[model samples]
Target: MYAIVEMAGQQFKVAKDQKVYVHRLQTEEGKKVTFDNVLLLDDGKNITVGAPAIDGAAVEAKVVKHLRGDKVIVFKKKRRKGYKKKNGHRQSLTEIVIESIVAKGAKKAAPAKAEKPKAAPKAKAEAKPAVEKEAPAKKAPAKAKVKADDLKKIEGIGPKIAETLVAGGIATFADLAKAKPEKLSEIIADVRGNHVTDTWPEQAKLAAEGKWDELKKWQDELDGGKA
Candidate 1:
């Protein structure tokens, strides 16, 4: 099971035992935290999408550690002004291990109840009829196929990331087209830690604009280290 949860100002899609890093929270290390803003849940069989977020659905996580991100160098330069400034900054972050996911009001199977003693069976001799009723064969429900381009169809997904999403069952243009940036960000973060924003929404916008060739060209440039 997996759930899409919101923490700090960002959303995260997490599954059991998965570790996630996000903006630092006030909670201490090793403490348990519950994310109430559960936007979606997938139980392998069915996906429950939240309208603004599913009511009564929650994701439980344990704080693993509090740490700082790698130093980011900020360099500013002015042409002909001889003005140059260099600075470094590190962001505080929290590492969390996802626990169980629960959907509100989901029914649990009840344990077998005790039964009373059965009465003695009556002895009766009867001839069995040769006629038999045929039981109708049950048909299996059709499984939805995840498409390779569906992930790319989302508002902020790239080719490689789209491959991951498609393999993970997020196939279909409509499925990805309906996904929010925040939700897609969560999925991307889960896949490629900390680098989800580089080319997500932009790619999605291109798909939405029917600019498949342009999108592929841009992706090629990025892959070729041109950008």
Candidate 2:
């Protein structure tokens, strides 16, 4: 019977008494090692495949020896530039012999605990008297919706920063006009690159008051949305 198992980050198809060279393991020579990552097992008559690895299966082996592999040379060259480089490396390896493949073991997997059945969903609470709920509903959203300003029309505000301002509850021109420059910067703290908010509140004040010609004259004299 043979089993495919993973060891030291590599996989090998191994059988009892079979010796395999694999990446160096920390175990000393002559110490026993067990691999529980058995991906496939074929016991002469039956074949068992693991979803990823068999739960109770393992491959037992003995560490025979540790050694380094033959040196491999690596060379590099650049034409015309006359650059040349060379290197060599040897891999650490271990020799191990498979001693046994245990399909099931004394250390068997624990049976999974059964999940408790879900409690039936609670029934909805009975509705209150219509007059009681209706009174509160009328007063719930008392704050009227304010018309939002085109904040991008402000010199220092771009599309992304405009959305950020709106999300921060500064949706209208009047809101922007009253906002402090430092506070505006805090609102759009995540906007890309540094922004000079020095003149934004001033510009917003003009836009909120419907003085477009004056706002435009000031914007034309500004640079990169900065005062």
Candidate 3:
């Protein structure tokens, strides 16, 4: 039997005793890990597919080791601009050997349930005589609500980060411009990646001032919000 399972953000077709290398997992070496995201499974003569992932289907694997992949060279250059940059990177990876494929009845790790709070005691109602009151002669006009700006316009600010920033009350370009890089980092701490917000505030300032041309020029020279 073979199964297509998603592990560490990547999918692979695995079978019993098969070794596979995937993105780095938080699991320690020599420990066993269960991947419940089985996309497809085949048992000799029958094939089963999932809408997104099959429920109760899991692929068990044992971590072999943790290591880094081969080095990758990244080269960047601009014609007639005298701009050239070269970098190298190695991706962290983990090796694991598939142990078994469970078609059903796989037990998932459930979170601990929190105890519910007790209900408040009900208060007794008291009857009181109603009094007639005079209404105000005039009411003040409502203030206009400020529209949220598309923060994705700023380089390095993706949909997830933009949503997170909006949730943190930094919705408009003016608001982003006024925010500090350290605070922005704190707001997006849950987001994956080594995001650099050094140029975000300046980019937001330019956008807030309606300097699209300048902002675009600066963004073109930036690499994910870093100078």
Separately for all candidates shown, the number of backbone clashes (residues 3 or more apart, or on different chains) is: 2, 0, 0
C-alpha lDDT values of all predictions = 0.66, 0.80, 0.82
RMSD of each: 15.4, 20.4, 9.7
Model 3 CA deviation exceeding 4 Å by range: 105-227
**Residue lDDT tens for model 1, 61-156:** 899988878866656799999997544445557899888888874433455899998754443212222222222234457797543455544323
TM-score of 3: 0.51
Residues 100-186 of candidate 3: C-alpha lDDT, one tens digit per residue: 999983334456899998765443212221211222334467899889999999987889999999999999999999988767866
Which candidate number has the best TM-score? 3
Candidate 1 achieves a global lDDT of: 0.66
Worst 10 residues of 1 by lDDT: 124-133
Better of 1 and 3 by TM-score: 3
Sort by lDDT, best first: what order?
3, 2, 1
After TM-score superposition, what is the CA distance of residue 206 in candidate 2 from its true location, in Å?
65
Candidate 2, residue 158: how far the Cα is off, in Å: 43
Give the clashing pairs for model 1.
156-200, 156-201
lDDT of 2 by residue, 1-227 (tens): 99999887678999999999976677899999999999988989878888778888999999999876675565679999988754444555689999999988323367899999976544523444555778876775668778888899987577999999999999988888788865776676567644556677889899988999999999887754554
